[model samples]
Each structure stands twice: as C-alpha cells, then as structure tokens.
Target: MANIQWFPGHMAKALRQLRENLKVIDIVFELVDARIPEASRNPELNDAVGTKPTLLILEKSDLADPRATSAWLRYYRQHNQAAIAVDVNDRKLTGDLTKAAREVLKEQRARAAEKGIQSETVRAVVAGIPNVGKSTLLNRLVNKKVAVTGDRPGVTKKQQWLKAGKDLQLLDTPGVLWPKFEDQLVGQKLALTGAIKDSLFAKDDVALYAIKWLRKQDQLTALVDRYHVTTEDLSLSDVDLLLAITQRLGFKDDYERASERLIFDLRKGKLGRLTFELPEDSEATDNA
Candidate 1:
C-alpha cells in the first residue's frame, strides 16, 4: 500500500522522523495491499521496526481476491496470526480487532505486567502505502473522522493520532515506500489498480497490466464480454482488445472510445469477483 512517487522531497525527512519514532511504538500495524500483499510489504519499514511485534493487516480485503487473503493468513500464522484480512468498515470489526490485537500483544503485555506496569493503553501505528484506507480505517475504528479521505493517493501529509478506543490508540503517518521494486509484475499490478501515482506509470502500461490479470481471471471477463471482445484467442498485446470489450459493453463509438471506456470499467471492477491468490495456490507453489 505504500506509494511514495510524489513524496520525494518528504522521503528523507520522513525516514529520519520515522526512525526517531519507531522506538516509542508498541506494535507495528504493517498493512499490505490486500490485492497484492507480497508486493506492498515495505522493506524499509521492516528494517526500521526490526523484530518488533507486527500485525500484518491486509487492508481493503473486500476488494481483493479472497482466496489469496486466506492463503496469506495461514502463511503468516506461524508468528501468531501475523497476517489478517479485514474490511475496515465492517460493523463487527471493532470487537474482532480488539481480540486479535490482544492476542498479538499477549506476550509483550505479560512482560509489562511483570514490571509492575498496568496496561498503559495499547498504542499501535497504522501504516501502509497511500490510499489503502489507513486514515479511513482509523476513523472507522473510533467512529470519527480524524483524517482526510480522498480518491487520490498520498493525502495524509503528517502524523496524527486517533483514539481507537478507551485503551487503543492509532498513530497515523504518511504512506511509505520500499527502496525499489524487486518484482516487476508487482509494479505493474500496482499501477494498473491505481495504487501507484499516475505520474509514475504509463497509462498504456497500466492498461496492459490490467489486461494481463483480467484476461486470465474468469471473473474479469464480464467486462470483456460486455465490451464485445471476441475471446477466440485472448491476447494481452492486442491493441484492438479494448475496442472489442468496449463495443460489447455497448459503446456506440470507435475502438479508441471503447478502449478508454473499458479501462475505466476495469478499474472500477465491473468484472466479477476474483481472489487472485488461494491457500492451495500458495501451498502448491511453496511445495513446488
């Protein structure tokens, strides 16, 4: 969830400030993009918070592939359910999270108890890439709008705090980025989903990334079928593919217009539900 393409000037300073604050935090809520958890994990953050108790929250889980989300939960469970998928707005989440957080913090809390420390309230840092609902999730937990919400990314420019509950506190910071992308497919996926800043990715490249995944996932074909693409031979490189999709969707215009329309439709998920990763998929891959 970390997109820092626009925050170059703030990058160094943010890192400096982040280093100073990491020591004071109790737990790191390392949020990954639910759609691409393997990609969104920030190595810089991982280095900074070295060995700190971390709750790997796969945010925006509702929009991601459910099978992938479930797989990740099992994958990270060796560290006491290190990963979890949650839709922040779900009404039952407050109670569910409280239980989960307590479980994650039990050992640390126990150590504190031995030192004659009563619970000094649970302080957690909610951090992830831009636009993954870090601020929105914080607001929902406390039932208040403590930060700005926007369709655009990188909106929160400063660190803020929200009282998640009587004993739970959320520390909000600007989104962070890893040093570089080790996986190119991850980069493309980010751009295609509007996860990366528009300036950082070429529009056509993003479109192709969308096509790459959408073409293979059956659920994504609803838009393709609507757009009238003759899926006789699905080709990601075919420039006319968008035209077919758009026309099938009933656009009364040239292929260019249809392509543009299809792009919008793809971004908004007119395609059906898809969980990009399944537990079996990961397990099978791991076994291989």
Candidate 2:
C-alpha cells in the first residue's frame, strides 16, 4: 500500500492539547467508524486517555453490517469497556449517548453524591481520527450547527467546548492521526473509508485492496451486481477486475474514474452494509 503515513502538524498539537486538557474532562467519548472500529481507533489516543472513563461510540452504524456491529458491541462489553453503536442521523442518538455516558460515569456520580454535591455536570471530550464524524456527532448531540461539518478530514482545526445536555458538556477537538501506522492494513482501511486524504494514496491501489478484502468476505457479489459485471469477471485479478469494471461502465480510458466510482459507491453505502475487521481479528490483535 506504498507505506501510507500522514501526520499533520495540527494533529500533533491536538494530541498535546488533549493531554493537557484531560484533567478537566470527566469522560472521553472515543468515536470510531463502525465499519472499521479497530482501525479507526488511534492507539496513541487510547494510551493518552488511560484509566479515564471512556464510552466507545461506533458512529455511522447504519453504514456497517448490523451483525458485525452487534459482535463488536459484545466484544467491548466482554472486555469490560462501555461501548455503543450509533448512527448520527438516528432519532434516538442523543438518548443512546446519554444512557451510555450515565452508565460509564455511574461511580463518579456516586462519589460526587457522597461529597454532598448535587447537580454535578459531566464533562467529556469527543475525540477520533479525522473524518470519522466527530464534528457531525457533536452537531447532532447539540441539535444545532455548532461544529463545522464536512465530508473530508481536518475540518475542525481548533477546540471548542459546547453544551450537550442539562448536565453534560463536551469539548470538540480536531481529528488527529498518529505519526505512523504500525500496520499497513490500518492505513489501507483508513484510506478506503475516507479518513485519510484522497491525495495521499492512489485510487486504484485502494480500490484493489478493497476488492481483495471484499472478495475474501464474499462481498464482491455486491460489487458485481452494482456494476453489472459478468460471472467471468469475478475470477479476474484485482487489477483486471477494475479494468473490466471500467470498460463495462464506458470509462475505457479513464481507469481512475472507474476506481473512484467503485470507492464512492462503497462509501455511499450503495453496495451494501460492510464491515472491514471482525471482532475475532481485533481480539487476536489485542492479544498480540
């Protein structure tokens, strides 16, 4: 995958700022893409937020396989981590987040009550890698256009604190990526999901990776069906698959456009609900 690596200067600053501000934050809403929960998570951020109460929110649940999302939820619960899958556009999103946050902060709430403190407001930071919908989730949580929303990464450059509910406040931070991706697959997954900038990687390379992975999961049928490819096309190599798709779609000379179309359709959920990494794979990685 050409050793993909991206770490903007602002991301480094964001990490430093988050570390400095962690003291005031009561809980961390660690947002991850439901389609790639493990890859979407920044290991450095997890380490920096160590021992703090964190609610692992799998955003964009609607774009992920429902069964896979359930498995991930169970996996987190088994590991004693509070987690929930939520679609930003869902009507019950606010309530789901509120309930999950309350559960994570139950002990903290009790301690405050013991100190004779009433009406203790919970403070949390909404954090994630770029373009994983941190800003969109914040806007949804507040039910307004408070944070700038976009389809690309690095939209929110500065941090801002906003009210979420009667007793909850949230700090919205810019999306940050680590200096390096230890695993190449992590980079590929991030790139495919639009978390990484398009200019960083070749469209055909990412599309080929997506094709190989989808083939393993038996999801290439969706691709074939989406593009109306013949049965013989399935047996073709990754590059050949793209070429065939391009030719079939009348983009004979524009292979890049064909690759982009495939990627766009996948991202837009036109193919089907897909999840890249399974719970078993993540669990093994955790042990390793």
Candidate 3:
C-alpha cells in the first residue's frame, strides 16, 4: 500500500492551479475526514498556501467517534489551527464556516476596515484528498447542486467558483493527493477511510488492518453484534477472524467478497464510529 502511486495528471494540474490562484484566496478551507484527519490532510498544501489563513473542516463528524472528534478539535486548537467539525446536514454549516473564516482573517478584515473598505465576502478555496466530501460541502454551502457528488473518490475533476449566501465566494478545486505516501500506515488509513479508490489496494488487506486495530481497541463490539460473532471468535488471528466473519456473513469460501463487504460496512459506519489515529500517535504532536 505504501508503494501506491495515485497522483493523477489532473491532480498535478490542479495543484499548479491552486498555487497560481493562492494570491487571491483569502482563506483555505482544508477539509479532512473526521475518522482519519491527519492521514487525509495534503501536506503539500502548507507550502502552496503560505501565510494564508486556513480553517480545517472535519467533514463527516456525524460518522466519527464523538469523543475522538472532540479530542482532535482540542488538539488543533492547542496548535493554533482553526478547525470545526461539520456534517453536511447541519443547518448552521454556512454560518459557522463564515464566522470561522472571518475570525481567522480578523486582523486582515480589521485592516481593511481601517482603510474604509467594507466587504463581507470571503474568498476561500475548498481543498482535501478525494472522497473527503468536498462536493457535498460545496453544494451545502451554496444550497444547490452545482457540483457532481458521489461516494467514491475523484468525483470533482475541475475547478470552479460557487457562491454561498451573501458572504462566501468559494473556489471548489478537485481533490489533490500527494504523489506517494511516505508512511505505510498512512496509506492504509486512507484506504480504510475511502479517501483512496477501492481498486487501488486489496480490500482484504484493509479489512484485516481494520480488524486488528479495532480488536486492539476493543471496538469490535458493533462488528460482533452485526455478524453475531462470539467473544471467543474475537480472539482468533486476524486472518482466521476475518474468515470466521466471512462464514457467518454467508459468503461461503468467498472471503474476497466478504472483505469488500466488511470494508464497505466500516466506511458506512455500520460497524461503528471509529477513529483511525489520535493526536498522541502523531509525530507532529511530539514536535509541537
């Protein structure tokens, strides 16, 4: 999985365009999956968006563990990074983001006000890796289906501008992923979160990774309940455990199909709201 290279040609072009358009962007709305915030972030963005204000949107908050989400919010606040957890269905989504962007650019807004320039409009670019819900966020902000949306990655392939009420003029860009993942675990996390295309990696590998991690956390209750697997079954090896669950799921010997189903259930929150990484697991937290 670490050797997976998913940098499409259009993504490279989008990065170039994002850099070229950064001068006019007032704030960057860096969206990341709430379940894998650190893994979902595009590291190249910081260099491209130097000195610009940024508000991190933890998209799909409703689908992640609430306690873990709260901890991540606190972690970002401690690092002086402005972040907010959001679900596309939240009524206050627009207002909350507008306020956060204004707060991040408060000094700039104040400076503009002193010069007798009054403008409520904020120019922000929505950015993150694919399938992190950029299109859904855009449609919700504008209150219209201006961008194509899907459950898979790479839905929005081009850049376009859309408006949200009276204050936000959003630049919606295609999801950008770095050329290569330096950490094997980061790649696996992305795969498990659906940030990477399902075809790019083996479904069974991701499923086994999820099972091992969840079992360690004792977070496999939902899986057991859904599949009717016993506590003794949980003590089995990862491969044996997956096979047992596969048999219970009535897939016969087709563990591959069972693997795909398991991955789907994990992503859809059928198993439960789970967080793949914590602040303590981050090297950045150590450095900070």
Q: What C-alpha lDDT, on a 0 to 100 scale, does residue 202 get in candidate 3?
A: 84
Q: For residues 214-237, what per-residue lDDT tens digits would candidate 1 score against the true structure?
A: 656655456545555555535535
Error of 2 at 161 (Å): 0.8
Per-candidate clashes, comma-separated: 12, 0, 0
Model 3 superposed RMSD (Cα): 1.5
Worst 10 residues of 2 by lDDT: 117-126
Encode model 2's per-residue lDDT on 57-118: one tens digit a residue. Answer: 99888999999999999999999989999888888777778778988888888899899976
What's the lDDT of the predicted structure labeled candidate 1? 0.67
- What TM-score against the true fold does each predicted structure earn? 0.84, 0.96, 0.96
Output candidate 1 Cα RMSD: 3.7
